[model samples]
Target chain A: MAGGTEIVAHRSGIEKAVAGLILVACAFYCFHALGLNFGSLSNPRSGFMPSVIGVSATVLAAVNLVLTLRKHRMAEADEVALDRYTALNLLMALAGTIAFLVLLDLAGYVVASALYLLFLTKLTRSPGWLVPMAVSIGATGFFYFCFVMLLGVTLP
Target chain B: MENFALLMQGFQASLALHNILAALAGVTLGTLAGVLPGIGISGTIALLLPISFGMEPLTALIMFSGIYYGAMYGGSITSILVNVPGEGASVVTMIEGYQMARRGRAGAALAIAAIGSFVAGTLGVVGITFIAPPLAQVAIAFGPPEYFAIAALGLLVLTNLSGGSALRAVLMMLIGLMLGTVGMDYMTGLVRFGFGVDGLGDGLDFIVIVMGVFGLGEVLARICERQNDVRVTKIKFKDLYPNREETRRSILPIFRGGLIGAIMGLIPGPSGTISTFASYALEKKLSTRREEWGKGAIEGVAGPEAANNAASSFTMIPLLSLGLPFSASAALLLSGFMIHGIQPGPMLVSTEPVLFWGLIASMYIGNLICLILNLPLVGLFASVLRAPMRYLMPVVALVTFTGAYVLNYSLFDLGVLTFFGFLGFFLQMSGYSLAPLALGAFLGPQLEQGLIQTMVLTDGNIWTLMTRPLAGTALWLGVAMIGWMIFRFIRQLLRRSSSQPVAEDV
Candidate 1:
């Protein structure tokens, strides 16, 4: 019988390989922690439903691995060269998020937000100091007006 | 007669200057974020949600709706100008829209979209004004069992929309149901899925998950795939509006699109995306000039764009009448009602008729504002597409962080945002369509609740769903949907299998 069809840069083998391994490891851990057997409708248990989830997840993971082996091969994605700069950009984006959080805790929302905006503006190779500075301030002021003044949501 | 007078008063109230300005602000901000890659409407709404907290409930809701519709419009911009369709519905538009752009008909394509959105949105508002109260009367009589039935029907509707992959959709829906189980149990209020984290006590914020999956994940995937320069040329001025002939050809599609949108909007669930996709598929299939489709056929852009906006307006019907929020935008608006300490249901009709009818009436006002602002600002919007990737990424990241943080003023929110963002990114990178995943997230909880309720009401006899007429019809409909999907799947497999030998033989 025919299985899954071919797709361009389709992720079958690699995804299954990775997700399968994680599923196996995670499912076992989850099973050990949470028991199966959610009691009858009269009495539901905490670990009851989770046991099914954990066990089923493990089985699904194993099934996925088999499907990957049968339906796909690594060579399908070989034509494409994985670019490096893309990875770097993603990392920068993630790191920037980390920094923004740290800054939010240290400074108030306005100051930290302004600084982060300026930094982001610079990444675009945005010309001129005025635009970024003006934007940063405007963003900060806007947030202050919206969060602090209106919603009664206290933003530090 | 007094009711008519009250309705008129609410309608006039929506036309006020402040409400107009608020709607303008929302759509403008929404378009900016929605047009941008990785900045989805949900994310923009979530980011702006904290700000909405401080505004008057009406102002907050108008702005929120603007953002929702604006994102729909904005999403089409990138899809047409570039090949990236920020949302799934835009994928259909992208087929014909970007093709039109590449051929340098971007202006006409965009013009059709704007006009179509206006026509549909206006009609949808009209529909809501007349239909909502009657629907509310029915909804008022609904018990928990009825709600369970509605949710079950929504799942059935979703199954038909799995883009032909029913199995994957079912699996995804189940996963969403499981994830929805993670917070404190609704009945028991018992802690679940806390993972020892205090933040998990309340469960993952729905908005947070949407942003991570739709906003941050999209950016991450783009970064991974587009390490090299990935800019597309911006659409120029002359190409902005469709010619007379194009407009003539598009009229019927626009009307049909509006009707579809209005109807879809009143439904419970993520009908915005579903409606748009359905319209585009229908439009493409019906268009006399089918070959023009995916070649940036103006109808492709017009139909879906109109549908999304119409749905946005009509969604207010159920929210105003029954206080039902099937989609995120409606939920956001529903939250507005709660903030004012006014529950939005049957009582909202009599109790807060002003707020209820005012918002509905304001939709007409909002439609006018959208036309005035959006069309004139197309050129300016084009410039946004030219923004370099580096700057866009960090801004999106920071916005994600700040938006999450401001919501709870907790550092833990940031952690939740980033972690989910990564998970979202991974899901995208792995080729699992996020649309189904997100749709499942929105629908799963409600479906589970419905299933449980239906089961309970039936007294442990799972077959009672078929015994009750309305609920049974819905159950049968759900089964039919699954069966149809299975049939489609088999057909697809056969088509693929049949075609394979030809390729090898060649």
Candidate 2:
């Protein structure tokens, strides 16, 4: 129970930090908008709407931050449990997407997409190498036929 | 007489051989897509958008129009056979429809839902045919202030109606609005928020976000959750029809649901889902057999299914007439219009009468096709649940990623997809809905343009917003909606507090 409380506290800290980061981002955007000249409302310049939204967003984020902090004080913060395997799977998904992004322009769509699919399939379940390879190849071939051959979409 | 003639001409165009085949293929594919558990209406449309890229605009539209109503029919299939709703609008259908299925009436539930959807869809198209042109004519008189009021009101209502806390919804909406302000300012020709990236000079593609957030994010979420083995009861053809009394009980509810759905569709803000819920509530209130509501009531299946299909059909009005999309699905249709190099607005009818009328005409044919398609294939579609998520999600992810990459062929868009997917997952995990955010992103620029134009016309005087009749009414309606939400929030808070004492005492 004590360990659970500790984990909750740790999660709360992370949550508050994320809220603070949002506030900071809002401030940064507002600062950028302020740098651009704010024309009159009648003849608004490029920055007018952005600056207004930026300010409004900053206020909302501030309110959200306050609410989060208050909820934390009341000890009612919800803890989102992240199991190790699930976390690993999420990271693997992210890695696969990043790899696809890099390989998309380099290795081309078929190879990159196949690699990403294979990686994701393997990450989700411990499939044999053959199954992952077969699935990836099949998926890539289908995408190519539908998108490239049929739809006339250009791919790298 | 003139409108009838116009519709006849549209049928003449829509009934062409190629168009018929497109409609058939579209509804078939759409029903299959909708029958899949994780693939939603918006996600299905987004994934298939690339396939339509090569087709002529009319053919593409005939296909899309088929998919639109076909999804409504397909959604109720899974809801009845399994407890899982294939789409958001069918969530309420699962409540009572599943119970009906459990009582050995799955076939009856499915049949009633299909019939209701067909009735609602047909009536809704009829409503749209008459109502849209007049609405467009009226919209022609609207100035920038009126347009701004309408668009801003839509964003505000979306934020309010989105399921979550008001603060979080507003925050997400503001974030979406900020995201919209990225890229270059059109009026000033000034680059903003590009952060030195060449691709950011043009605003983010809506399709990329749709693919990422709705498609890949959902896939990731599904992957993280443990899959449960769902049991599907085999439905036979002979058992499809309800008894005579059951049919009698359903007819009134179906008509009521269609009426409710058609009206809600015109109002915006998750209209399809809202209409279903509203119809279900209305049915419960008015049903003589209210005692059987939670226990596999036939009215439960009929009303919401009818309402959602009707709502889906009429939801086109705002997009077609006013050039504003109320939901992500409507936004997809708007994107479809833009892809065809035709803008949807008050001038759409005048500018592209054939395209506009042809789409409306095709919807009627699509409805007929969906009814023909879904009623017999409910059993086959329900068996799709046997496919495990492990095998399914990987394919979904691949399609989503490919769709994103193919849109602009930009690695930067892939980056956007990844970022938004991550963001969408986090927001969804935190119990924040993405509909408001999506609405904000879609409507934000239009709202900005309308506001700026109005400002220029009014010389920056904000009070002139209230001086215009239509703009004033819209702004007041928006304010009233916000006020009502605040009141409801406070009342709920008070009730919670009052109940807390009783709980502590217990």
Candidate topping DockQ? 2
Global Cα lDDT for candidate 2? 0.81
lDDT of 2 by residue, B416-490 (tens): 988888777765655566777777777888888988888899999988888778999999998898899779756
| Model 1: share of true interface contacts reproduced | 0.27
Error of 2 at B200 (Å): 0.8
Clashes of 1: 13
Which candidate's lDDT is highest? 2
| Chain A TM-score across all models, in listed order | 0.69, 0.84
Off by over 4 Å in 1: A1-14, A21-37, A42-65, A74-82, A99-103, A106-153, B1-6, B95-105, B222-242, B262-297, B311-347, B439-458, B480-506
Error of 2 at B251 (Å): 1.1
The Cα error of candidate 2 at residue B462, in Å, is: 1.6
iRMSD per prediction, in order? 5.5, 4.5
